[model samples]
Target: MYLLTLSESKPPNIVFIVADDLGWNDVGYHNPEIKTPNIDKLAREGVILNQSYVQPLCSPSRSSFMSGYYPFRTGLQHLVIISFQPVCLPLNISTLPQELKKLGYATHMIGKWHLGFCKWECTPTYRGFDSFFGYYNADEDYYNHSLSRVPFKGYFLDYRDDRQPVRDQDGVYSTHAFTKRAESVISQHDTSKPLFLYLPYQAVHEPIEVPKQYENMYPNIQSEGRRKFSGMVSALDEGIGNVTAALKQKGIYDDTIILFTADNGGWVSYYGNNYPLRGGKFTIYEGGTRGAAFIRGTGITGNRTYDELIHAVDWLPTLVSAAGGSVTGRDGQDLWKSISTGSGENRTEFIYNIDDDFPPVEGHAGIRYYFFIFFIIPMLPVLMGDYKLIEGYPGLFPDWYKPDTEMSSLDDPVEEFMAREGYKADNGYQLFNIKEDPTEHNDLSTKNPEIVAKLKARLEYYRKTFYVKPNFPILPDFAADPTKFNNTWSPGWC
Candidate 1:
């Protein structure tokens, strides 16, 4: 049972901000090397979530947050959707914005819409949001707002306003543009009705380009990637500050709930770092899944970090409940009351991800990078209470380390790590007492047979009940080329 009582007659406006590929230790509050004053201020003044977990990859974590179900339930457990894939988020689930609009909310979505847009029906505007402004894919050129990568080899524009291609934002930096759009939404909003704004950023991801001014802020850092990353984070922080100021200027700061989180762990190989947490993105490790997050505003008791376990799936129910809506059927538990009470007991178990073994299907979606092949391990991890069970290959990402010092480094460019003898056991299980071994130093699968067996049984049940197979859909040869439509990706051939 959950208890949340709001004093104001008007329902609270909910604003959720997500930073793509931001690491656990990349924030100023978490690591002193990073410069994020706005994010740090929010985290310091609000409740810091020390144990917030999300899926290891981009689309999976995003889909979970949007669908109120695990990636395994959405068929996004394997990998991200490429430009050529005909699938989007399953057309079945009633999205978060849809639920909010039922209570008379004006829902708006700004910045990255990586959930899925191959079909116009799956676009945020079509799905639920009254207004949508952003791109439909990942790793787009930050300045030109274009995506030119493998599978779709030319600079195809993915930025959009509702369904039409956005051709005007050619030279504008994506972060600044999205920030202005968000502020505009807040300023023009009808105050009498509640508003739900979802702003997912495109900062600090690959093609790690930030304006020279942001990179100039980090002169002392020697690594170019880390330097640019710090600057990108600064830009993101400043934009967040701008959004918060807009909320305050609208005279709704007290009645608005502002949440900030990275979609998943940092891309350590590039400009991300999840230091002090084992491994980086794509591994079923703590660094890959645990998020740096906080919730500030109405009903929040401020200035503290609530130390406990929470999952990305929980946000749907928690935010819906915070807005005075009922979430009767979802794979998530509302945690607002538990957070307010400092009980930290609303959740003690959650499955990190349920990944299927590689089947080597043609035209699978994967970032064409050295780290992508080295680090992307397909597996399952089920966390139950103090002991957590991992049933997959643990890639060789760097261990937790102090900042400014050289990172032990992300992943070794060799097959030895993935080919280690004990990497995948006979039964494919390894146990770690997360409460005790937070960095996951020791393996207890051999020692604690009963715990391993219990978690395995739980995984078996979840695997059987999954909504779809974890493997990504194979791209068909007849998929339409974006180049034919004047180099703009659209809901074509769907």
Candidate 2:
């Protein structure tokens, strides 16, 4: 029922950001050799979003953007929830900073809280984030912030300030201490309340450490891990140009909405590059769930390029319905009038990779409705509308285009590129119109066997009524329950 219209006496100021494994042509508006001029000036004032979509990893794309649901409905689909695990992100869900701190807004959160802290009510300031500094686990060490994994047997550290335990943030450089705590939380916000922040940024993830003055601004990047990952994406694009000049020096730059995405894609063994879109990060292909997005301040409207089809659980009901608030029973789709009138495409994405073990499911799943896109793990594909039915061979690292010294003896490049490209599941799929073959290299599933049996019966009816199970808690084997390691239960621990 929302068709866009807001300005309940000015409510803007959101900021968001994200960016961990970041790639899909590593910024500078999709690579001009990655300088990322402040995310290419927020993709030239903002809009871009060529096709968005996420959740190929990183705590299931941050638990589908803090629970607008769908990381297999919040069990956090599969990989990444590591350090101290007793599981999390289910304190009876309802986040997105507890619906923008119940609309009075000011809900902070600086950087990388790999979505679970084990206890203290699963951290992020007890889950609604009135403030949270950073690092809860999953990758740290940018100047000994610790955690290179030694989970319960000691050495964790993981830097924090809001929840304390901050050993004077050792040699800084966690993307310049999370962009100087997001420009000191936008220079001590409070301007009549209306600020969300949520930076994220564990820059170009990995121990690829930067700061040698951003590795002397990439000396002609000859690959020392892609010039330390283009100097950690040019120090996270100059800390997002000092957080958009601290929101235009706190006059709240055009009221401020911002966004900029990425939680997945780009990790071709860490020199990360989703070039010409294929497979990367943990593979759902289309370069690991098509990320590299955008949004930009206020009512949006800037250098355009929408292409609809958004996701990452539609930015928590499209920034809580662009701050006027109220987006009830949300599974994210407020998309603020299809991203401010760039026209419609509504939204229909399933995209999966389930496997915390529940119904003999192994990994990779898909759906996308209008303009079709079915898929199924053992290289199935599907796609429709711009055709694509593929049945194997999409490179989830078949020497992912080799050349990193032949990827160290090709250690299982998607099982030797599916047995040197023979991929047989009774050899049946291979169509491709990906709008004139966006590089699946033409096949046409044997000239459309009735659109591959009608997109494989709509991906088997969304895998039997929306793929179930996995409601959190699974990383147990703590060597036969060493008293289940700690945080057994929280959230008003009865």
Model 2, 39-128: lDDT tens digits are 887777767888787877788789789877777666677666766466667888888888988888989988887777656787888888
lDDT of 1 by residue, 273-296 (tens): 887888777666788788999988
Q: Which lDDT value does model 1 have at 391?
A: 67
| Cα-based lDDT for every prediction | 0.77, 0.69
Off by over 4 Å in 2: 1-7, 22-170, 190-204, 209-263, 266-268, 271-279, 282-287, 290-334, 337-345, 348-444, 447-494
> Which number leads on lDDT?
1
Q: Which whole-number lDDT from 0 to 100 does residue 124 have in model 2?
A: 88
TM-score per prediction, in order, is 0.89, 0.31
